[model samples]
Each structure stands twice: as C-alpha cells, then as structure tokens.
Target: MPKSLIASAEWSLLLSRLRALAPEAFDSQGRVLNLVAREWGNPGHGKPYLSPVDGSQLGLLPMIDLSTATHAVASAAAEAEEWARVDLDTRKARVSACLDLLHENHELLALLLTWEIGKPVPQSRVSVERCISGVKWYVENIESMMEGREPLGLISNIASWNYPMSVLMHAALVQALAGNAVIAKSPTDGGLLSLTLAMAFARRCGLPMSLVSGSGGKLSEALVRDPHIACLSFVGGKVNGRDIAASLYDRKKRYMLEMEGVNAYGIWRFSDWNQLAKQLKKGFEYGKQRCTAYPRFVVERGLVPRFLEMYLPMLTSLKVGHPLLGETRAAEPPSVDFGPLINSGKVEELHAMMSEAEAKGAIPLYKGRLEPNLFLPNQDVSAYLGPCAFLHVPRNCRLYHNEPFGPVDSIVVVDTEEELVTEMNVSNGALVASLACDEPETARRIASELRAFKVGINTTRSRGDREESFGGIGQSWQGCFVGGAYLVQAVTEGPPGERLFGNFPDYTLLPEKR
Candidate 1:
C-alpha cells in the first residue's frame, strides 16, 4: 500500500504549535487574521469557514476593512514602478525561487487544501504541481510574449474557490513576469490557507505581502474602480464577472474575465463507447465543481441505449466518502471518487435543480442517493450528493441550459450531425465542447459550428498544455484568454505600432481623394 498523504505526527505537532502561538493568525470560531505587509490584523466581522468534509465549522475568515484595503492597493500601486524597473533576469529568478519554495512546502499546502476545500489529497497535490508548472511556464515564455509591450501597472487578480491556488498562482506569476505589480483578492470561500501561503512565499522573494492580500466585497469593488489598477483578472461566476466588466468599461481598464460555462460533449454513432466512457467519467472529478466539466452530453439517437448501458453503471458505482481517507486503511473504504459539495447549500441547490428537471418531464435514468453511512464517524453526510444520470431531458428544462455545477448529468439525444451541433450550441456560452466522432470531416464541421473557445475531438477534459490559450467566447468570457501567450498581452499595454513587426502602409496614406 502507498504511504498516507496526511501529515505525520511531527508535522501536525508543529502546525498546532504555530497555531497556538498566533491563534489570531488562524481562523477560529468567528475571528480571522488578515495579512497585510506581514502584519496580521483582525477586522472583527467575519464569515464562518465550514468543512465540506463533515459540515463542521472550521473557523472564521476575516474580512478586510475598506480603508485598510485601499491603503494596501496604494502600496501596491507605489511598488509597481519599482518592480517594473527591475531587470527581467532578476524578476525571472525571483519567480523561479518562489516556485521552489512552493515545492518545498507542497505537503503542508496540499493538506491545508484538502481540509479547507474538501479536495482529495491526491488531487490537491496535483493542483500544487499545476501552480508550480504555471510559474515555470510564464517565466520561460515571458520574454517572447512581452517583446515590445509595456507593463500595465498594478493588476488586480480576483480568484475563485475551486482550484484557488492554481488560478491565483497562474494570474500572479504571468502578471508579475510582465513587470506588473499585483493585488490578488482571496475568494470568500476556501481561499484562506492557499492565498496566505502564497503571500508569504512571494514576500520572502522581496514582493510585499500587502500587494497580494486582502478580502471584502466593498474592498474588491474599490480595487476595481481604482484608477491605479490598470488591469483586472477575474475568475468567478458569470454574473459577477459581468458586473466587474461593466465597472471597468468606463474606466477603460484592461481586464480578463474567466467565467463559468455549461460545457457539452457529443457522442456519435461510430464513437468507441469504452473510450468515450473513460473520458466522460472526468466530468465527475471534484464532483463536477470544475468549470470545464461536461455537464451536457449530446448522444446520437441510435447510440443512446448502448451509451446509457455503459455510462449509468459507472456513475452509480462511484464512491462518495471522506476525501482524506486512504485506500490502504483496513478499517476504511477505498479512496473516494466523489466527495461532498463545497457546503450543504450546494447540495440543496443541486437537488433543487435535478428536481426541477424531473418535474419538467425529464426521465430519470439513475436517481442519486445520499448515504449517511458512507461518511466517517460524526461527519455530516447532508452535503454529500451521489452522482446522477438523466435522459430524455426536455429542451425547455432549466438543466438544458444552466450548468448544474454538481454531480448531475443530462443526456440529450439528436438524430443528425446538424441536430447534434445545434444542441451543443444551445448553451448561452461554453468554454469547450468535446466531440466523439470517428469521421474527421464530421468532427471538423461540429467544431467549427460550436460556439466555444476550445473543441476537443474524442477528449472530454480540458487540456493542460501551458502553450495553449484557455478562454471562452460570447458570455463565457468578457476579455482575452487567461493562459499561454495571451496572458502577457492581458496584463500589459503598448501602442499598436509596437505590436507590428514589419513596416506596413499607413492607413492615412490611402488615396487623399478618398
């Protein structure tokens, strides 16, 4: 059996001692410690941080007062010029050193991520690795991407709870590489540990912690409105992203919005069922919390019965249990394939959405069950919802267009290639669409017609290649792509002529008579 990912006795003791010495620095009860410039401040009112694993109250996450937040933004603004002036080699070295620091502390961060966000230890570790890889990717590609571009001054990175560390690290590293100072706002839920650790590592590399730490709705709005913040990178729900974009429109501030999508997948008649099933299972990863998860499946009419026979059983067999449990534990069940939602509220929302679909005449292929006995002793299973499959969903049902954002699957049947593409394009917007067609021409046709930033052939999951651009079209994204070469552009600005390599005819030179 493999060794446990949970912290050992010595590490646990050390963490406990640190917490005891600075109780306020950690969230306890209804109090939280806000970090700014290496100083921990308590702003009084805070929200509770509940453990998704057991629905237990972990502690409180403190909110930053608007005044203090403003001061922090000013500090970041002042620091931007100095940071921009630093040599490119020195900046790259600093970023590389920070990556090393993250690797050295991977275990602690992974454990904290699991406890705070309810992600399994293995998956949490993957997130940390992804963060490290993002920094390295930015450092390696920054020079070419920046070319003649100038820094956009201070950038405000507002991150979301799902995959918080990866998103924050990706935005911060790329922005900093482009010589922009950044102030990253932690998500209201499950961002305390990841953001705090990242701030500490960044400060050690000579960046100010205040430049990257602070949390509060009003404070976040202020940051968006602040003229000094030249760029804003946000990752969250579509509604909030729209609000941020609207706020920035008048300011003419450069911003990149990474919003959620109701990603879809098309299964054709010739598609391999076994291979397709494997790809479809990824939708259940993290219990469909991922924005890229394929919630809607468009199956060919003739293939629907065979697809259901192969898919429903797999979804039903998924283990829903504590994320931290080890597969090697004799007394415990195997490692879980599905964990609880972020909180009990999410569970309720998912059930409501599913019930609405059922009421709208959708046939339930597999109704999900909530087993209280599946969890550990004293743990609340109310937040745990098992995987569900639905078939013959009506086009008018809310589930047809809305992203359930839970372990729920809706299968829509289509007769022809045109019908399949039409159904895939029904979502208001989508980041990606997966095509499981064997014919190259069919795949190409569907990919071109689908209104999404990315179209995968025979692959259901989002790609991990750092060189690939990641973003959506229409309502899915309000700005430029978030990763790859586009990120440098997202955080910097320069004249149009600077982006042009060769001399071209000036538009003013067009025939004077015209």
Candidate 2:
C-alpha cells in the first residue's frame, strides 16, 4: 500500500489539513479492512470491530504482528532515550514535532482507528483531537515531573484495544519526546489499529521500529521480564491484570495497571425526575460496556419504589440494536438493545454469571435472552443483540458485586448515603462512581465519601476521555492516571532531577580544602 502522508511546518496548518481529509476507511490500495453499514448500524468484516463512539465490538479485529510491534517499540525507545540526552528544549521540540505530525494526519489516524475498530466517524475524529490535546497537555507539564530524579532509563507501556491509537499514541509519543526509550505492547484484539499508529509515527514522526513490540502468551511474559523493561503500564481486565501484576512483582518491576470496575451510580435523593430520566437514558446509551460505565444503581430506599416506577418506562423505550443506523432515540430492536458481546465466550460468561445470580435467588425483574439476541437478525444483519434491564432482590448480591461489563444494569436500594458509600467502598474494585444529587450539600457529601478514582456528581462517569486522568483505584487499577498531563509524566519524566556529588579523586580533595 502507498504510504499516506502528512506534511507540515506549523501545527495549526497541519491540524487544519488533518481536519479537512475525508474518512479513509481503507488504505490507498484498498487493502485495509472494509466496513459495511446497515439500516441498524455499521456492520463489520474486520479482525477487530470496535465502535468508536463506544468500545463495543462489531466483529473481531486483527492483531498486529507481535514481532513488528516489538521492533517499533524498541526503535522508538532508543530514539526517545537519545532525545532525552539532548537539551530539554530540543527534546520538547522533537516531541512537539511528533505532535504536529499527529495533528496533521488526524483524519487518516481517525479513519484508521474507525476501520481497525468500529468507531463512528464523528467519535473517531474526537479521538484524534483528544490525542492532540493530550500531547499538548503533556508538553506543557512534563519537564517539572522529571526533575531531580535518578535516571531510571526505562518505560514499559502496555496498552488496550478500546482506544488503540489514542492510548498507545500517548504512551509512545510523549515518552519518546521526553527522551525515554519505550518498550510497549498492543492489545491482542486491536492489532491493526496499533500497527497503523506505529506506522504513522514511524513515517511522520521518524520513530524507530525497535521501541515498540508485542507478544502473545509466553512472549508477553518474556517482554515483562526483560530486565531493561523499566516502568510498566497496562490496560486490561482485572484477572489478567492481577496475573500480570503478580509476574511484575516476581520480577520486582515498577509498573502500573488499569483494570476493572464494578462502577455504580447513586440515584439522587431528590433529583429532578425528568432530568434524571434523561441522564440515566444517556448512561445506558453508552452501552454499559465501559470499565467506568454505570453498571449498578443504588437508589435511596425512600426513592426505590418511585424511581423504579418512573425508570422502567424509560428503560423499556431503549432500542438495543446496532449503534450506526441512526438509532439515536428509542430502545434497541424488539429483542436486543445493542450488538452481540465482543465474542461468543463473553456471551457465555455473561449467561453463566446471570444463571449463578438466579441460582442465588436473585429474581430477574427483566430477563434478556442471549440466544434470541444472537439468533435474531438486526437491521437485516445476522449479529445484533438488544439491551435488557434487570431488577434484582438485593444490592449485596454477587451480581451487583461483580461487574456486568455489558449493557445489563441492576438496582439496589440503600436507605442512607452512608450505606451507599459503604457499599461502593467495600467492593474490591474502585474505578468510578456517579452520584446523581442535585443539591450542593448532597453532591458534596457524596463526592467526599465516594471511594472511586473518578467521581461523577451529576453525570455518567466516562473512562475514554483523553483530557481526563483516567485509571481506577484498588482492584480496578494499580497505578495513577493514564491520559492528559499524568501520562506524559508517568513515562518521560519523574520527580525533580536530584543532584548528588560523589567523591572524586583530585577534585574531591580540592573541594574539601575549599
């Protein structure tokens, strides 16, 4: 395929050019994956089909060559380390240059993102803009974070598939600009997006190939164990993340991981019913698949009956079919609210969990059928699933405790704010929580008591924003933030450069005399 190009000397001009290009769903030679849209939404014929608006999948996305990714990581790292040795201004300039390139090619990058996954065109555009914003944010703040630190000289970047281009781009580009060599891994599901990003950086930013690498199975283990691999950063599920953390601990590696969340929302004690209804609808519209998505509702006991009475009609109105066919309003089709689970395994897992919940005596007020969803044709396609809302017996049930990680949500009634806080805190994970309070005192109280990393007082908390410092606390994550200013500091720089004078032969003697 012919290489796509981005040429610019000014950041503004470059960004403008990028904004002007049409969406490039395929490569110049028409070799990249193709997408098919139906009346329901965009369908997939790719290796990893993720919706750009939401990270939900349309089909399996392709994986990049692990060797190729590794090579790129290694090369980028070397380039970054060399850049770091240069004067700070020069390093920043180089970093700025890469950012300029990224801005200049935003359209290509966004389209590459869309095709690699299944992001809507508009959302894909936002991802690119967000990445640019992230780079600038880091550029403005990274220097102070690196001062007075012992030269650790290593950065480990483990990225996920959800926002493949944006996540890895931040880690790789900023670290390189800050003068640290990066050893990186791309998620197994979103390989093409990562590879396209790798190519873009190499072609436009002049990144070396060695700085980025990927491995599957034991290869990931080996990469993690590589002694030169320094600061490790990971994004994935809780189980695999913990296992990876254990391995890092065994190797005594300095690392961070973004994992899972049993995220929750506290329906306001006295919320405006109409506005609350709208917000809750928007929450479920997010497909309830994000790590930070509102997965459970803790309605004040005084309000549960009324809230249920008021909310079910709205819930029943959701159209849970495909996301692309402009199904903006209304519920999904008769059977499914959204598309199928990313894979059959996920479907089975969700069913197993639901069955376990049922066996535990949690009566499902609303049951969603996986078999029907899978078998039902949506927008005339073979693979869409509708959304389902279920009400359970108790909030303390295992289903409520564990993350559904899908569009499914449940309700739990708490009598007091204290109980709500206690329940949210007691959970082993802590990604985010949404408190839907209207009064200032109530919002403040909930915000103060909430134990999650990201708190949403009046809105659904989101994990995908680049400007936000996103990552979970507790089991949800093992690190600090992932984007905005924090990501730059996390990789390229550390605390203020520390100065220590060691004993020197003749020089030490003269200094003592002075």
Candidate 3:
C-alpha cells in the first residue's frame, strides 16, 4: 500500500486535530466520513473519496438509503421552524460567532481544501478569507435586508465542488441569516471539508440545518422533490440545473439556478497588454475550474499578435505541481500559479478538447507539458496538466462554443467592435465578461451592450464587491440575481408588512416637543 500523503509532521498534526473533532471521519489509515448512513454496517457498499492532488484514497463516503435521507430533510425542516422563532438579533450573534470560529480554524480548512480539491494552500487560504468576509458582510447587513421580507421556510441549497468553501457556504450562510433553515448537499468530490465547515457552523452557532454527502443522484432528487422545502438554490452544470428548474416549476416551488456558461474576455487595441496579461492569468488560477473563469478570449485584429506574445509566455510560466508543496506568497505566487485539475479523467478530457481544437485548424500557441517534479515515484500523476493555449480557433469548433472547464484557452481575433460584440454574445449568454480598453466611452458602450450580469472594465477577475448584486442573463441564470441585498430577498418571501417588525415605523421625537 502507498504511504499516506499526510506523512509530513505538520500535515500529520493537522490531521490529528481534525480527527479529534470528528473521530468517526478522520483516521491514520484514512479519513472516512459516514455521509449516507450514520453507521457503516456494510463496508463494501461505501464509495472511495480520492484526493485530486495525489490520486490517493482519502476516505470512504457511505451511500445512505432513501429513508435515511428523507429523515435528514424532515429533521432539517423541523429545526428550521424552531429557528425561525429565535430573535433576529440572537441569530445574528450566532452567525457572528460562527464566522469567528471559521477564522480561528482557517489553517485547518485551508489544508483540507488543498488536499481535497487540489487548490494550492495560498489560494485555499484566500478562499477561506473570502468566506469569512462574505459571512461578515451578510451578518452585518442582515437586519436591513431582512427587514422587508419573511423567511422562506426551508432552503434546499445544492453546491458545486469547484469552490466548496466560499461559493457554496456563502449562499448557505446568507439563507441562515435571513431566518430560513437550510438543507445543504455538498458535492461528493469535496464533501469532507464542506461537511467539516457546516458542522463547525452548527456547533458554534447552535443553528438548525442538515449538511449531507452523496453523489447528487437519488438523494438530491429526493431533496428537490420534497414538498416541504420552500426554495431550491443550485450552483452547477447547465444540464443538471435545467433538470432542477423543471422539477421546481412542476412543484410550484421558488428556485435560483446558477448554471455554467462559456464566459469571454475582450481586448481592444488600446488596452495595456502587460497589465492585462497579469490580470488574465486569473482565468486559469484554479485550472479554469471556476464558472466565472474566462475560457474564450476575443482580441481585436490589430492587437492579437501583441496580446499572444505577452499572454502565452505568462501562461507557459505557470507552475503545475502538488498543491501542498507549492511555494506560498503574500499575494499571488510568482513561481507557482496553479495546481492540478480535479482528477485524472478531467485531465484526459481537457487534453482531448485541445487535440480536437488543434485538429480543426486551431493554432497551438503553447501546448503545455507536465513537469517531472509534479509526480512521485509509483504515484499516479494523471490529475496534473500544465496550462494550454490556442489561437485562431474556428468559429464552428465545439471548443469555441463550449465551456472548457479546465486550463485551456482559445483566442479569436475580431476586426470591429460589432464583430467583437457578436463573438462575445456567440455563447448565447454568460455569467460575466471583462473588457480591456483605454477609453471610458468605449468601455461604457461595451458594458451597455453586454448580455452578462456583471462587466469588468480593464480587469479579468470575475468576482465583484461583496455588496454588489451578481447573476447572469438568458441561459446563464434563472429566477433572480444573487449577492448583496438581492440574496437576502431571494431566500425569503412576502413583503415588509408580513415580517415580524415590518409594520413598525422608526422611532422619532416630535418637532414641536424639540
């Protein structure tokens, strides 16, 4: 048998601490979490949880029976009702305490994220920090946001694995702060860390919720179909999102769908190529696994050569290695830019996509190669793939239209703003897009024409301020927008008058008395 990846003294110590908290989940042999059933009576039926960084077995996740799953949902609903009666201020205090707990255990969460999802420790730390910030923001603004709304009862939150910590938990925490109970289903690939975080929140906040683990097969289907669940919030692929939307529509339940799309990045001739290259590197920060990562690059015809010259080298220079072994820096790491893809199968799929694009007349600018240091002797290295770039990909190619949720980029040159806008909207609709131009007038014009929810000027990063409203247009999203004041409204229902203190006016002194 292969040696444990947590063999280093520091890693071993962290694992020991985590095991102490959840003894039934983490062990020296391997971490095992009973996701489905509480007891592992039949060990043979459990599924293996593989670490994307090393292709090693991290633990086994039990597949619970349907009756057990239903019980979990019912418990969550009952707890949510009880929680709804708690004073809003008391709930805010609990949420604040939970955020403090998360901050205190930041290191452990970062380490677990590095191993579970193949994100570098530095990047994982940033994600944890973002979660803390988001929670803090939601808690501070909760009273005002919830002032005009009533809790929507029970929220069935289904999150994706790409960003298990911040992206998933942000919504869950928001719903909780709005006085709604949550029944969260974490993705199977990254369930352990998410479960750990959720359990920590429950313990610290004394909140009512259920954090379950399983492939979104029968268990999730049951969750969405449950008549008791008031709303369904999902972040994942378009296909599964569509299925959930249809089910929710049939049941007459409110739902929020954040589906995947082929997001784009546009560069005008006047854009600063050097600084633009720096920002564009964010596109592949997590091997382009994020929904907001721009996979399509639409460049002006005059600037194509300059953009490629500056961008291809930056793409090639990115370090691909084990998530834990990479060097950490204060800001973004100069040497190591990203870690591995999710798994070996994903790596293979990305390579196949690149090959298909090349076969269809796409010019390979930098065909990435895995470094020798990325692998251990006798250890499977299939999960790791270096960054790849292609230029002048044909418009009809699938790579041009599809979301290549990996570290693969396609550059297309357009001669005019009209052509550029056409190319930008070619994906039908997207979550967001970034335009790099020097003129403010041009930026404003492009922003107005974009079909995206958010447009960045002279920036490639997808994330906006925590207080800003975010979502997509057309097929990219459904229901309503998310984040800021919008998020608090989505998880709850009814107008201000229906809420507990909605009918009351602000306290004031009479002008005559003064």
Q: Which one wins on TM-score?
A: 1
TM-score of each: 0.90, 0.72, 0.88
| Steric overlap count per candidate | 0, 63, 1
lDDT for model 3, please.
Answer: 0.72
Question: Model 3 over residues 325-435: C-alpha lDDT tens digits?
Answer: 532212222245677788888888877877888898999988778676554445567888888788888877778878888988888889999988888887777888888
When summed lDDT is taken over every stretch of 10 residues in candidate 2, the lowest stretch is 34-43
Q: Which ten residues in a row have the lowest lDDT in candidate 3?
A: 505-514
1 or 3, greater by TM-score: 1
Cα distance off (Å), candidate 2, residue 21? 13
Angstrom error of the Cα, residue 46, model 3: value is: 1.6
Off by over 4 Å in 1: 1-32, 37-39, 209-216, 327-332, 370-373, 461-465, 497-514
Residue 483, candidate 2: Cα error in Å is 4.6
- The parts of candidate 2 lying over 4 Å away from their true place are 1-80, 140-152, 208-216, 250-252, 323-341, 367-383, 393-398, 463-468, 482-485, 492-514
Q: Model 2, clash count? A: 63
